[model samples]
Target: MSQKPTSSENIVNQKYDRCLADLLVKTGVGFSIGVVASVIAFRRRAWPVAFTTGIGSGIAWADCDRLFNPTRGPGVRIVSQAQTPESK
Candidate 1:
């Protein structure tokens, strides 16, 4: 009952995957930097600096949730009518 995706769908999926992967990689780097900055700030006992750094770190980590979501990534617009029930 199920059929293979058309060439366009395959291309769209590939593009989405690539975009998602890039977003995750970039977000991970940002989060790593934030963590390092927070650690350095806390170690120096700079309360104000540490607080700001920790806040930035939390924001960075929060953004990771979007990077993990499928519909959030940039890619082709798949029309509903073209999608099979299984694919949808």
Candidate 2:
């Protein structure tokens, strides 16, 4: 029989509170970088270039977010862990 996860694991899987904070911090760094680079590119009359730069940065930096929460990330899934129903 599979042992049930303690409150800690459920908390990790369900709420993703810690994971969110961690990702926000990690992603926020690169996000700032992206914003700055995008702004610079836009100032150079390269809107498409600026927009794509941020998208690329977001895709690349998103791995850090997956490192914290895999199954619950908005639309990105870099990890392959199976998501299970919350056991009562």
lDDT of each: 0.60, 0.60
Please provide, for model 2 over 15-73, each residue's C-alpha lDDT reduced to its tens digit, 9 standing for 90 to 100: 46655565566555655655676677555445545555556556545754665557767
State, as a TM-score between 0 and 1, how close model 1 is to the true structure.
0.40
lDDT of 2 at 51: 57
In lDDT terms, how accurate is model 2?
0.60
lDDT of 2 at 66: 69
**Per-candidate TM vs. native?**
0.40, 0.33
lDDT of 1 at 17: 78
Local error of candidate 1 at residue 36 (angstroms): 0.2
- Show the lowest summed lDDT stretch of 10 residues, model 1: 44-53
Worst 10 residues of 2 by lDDT: 44-53
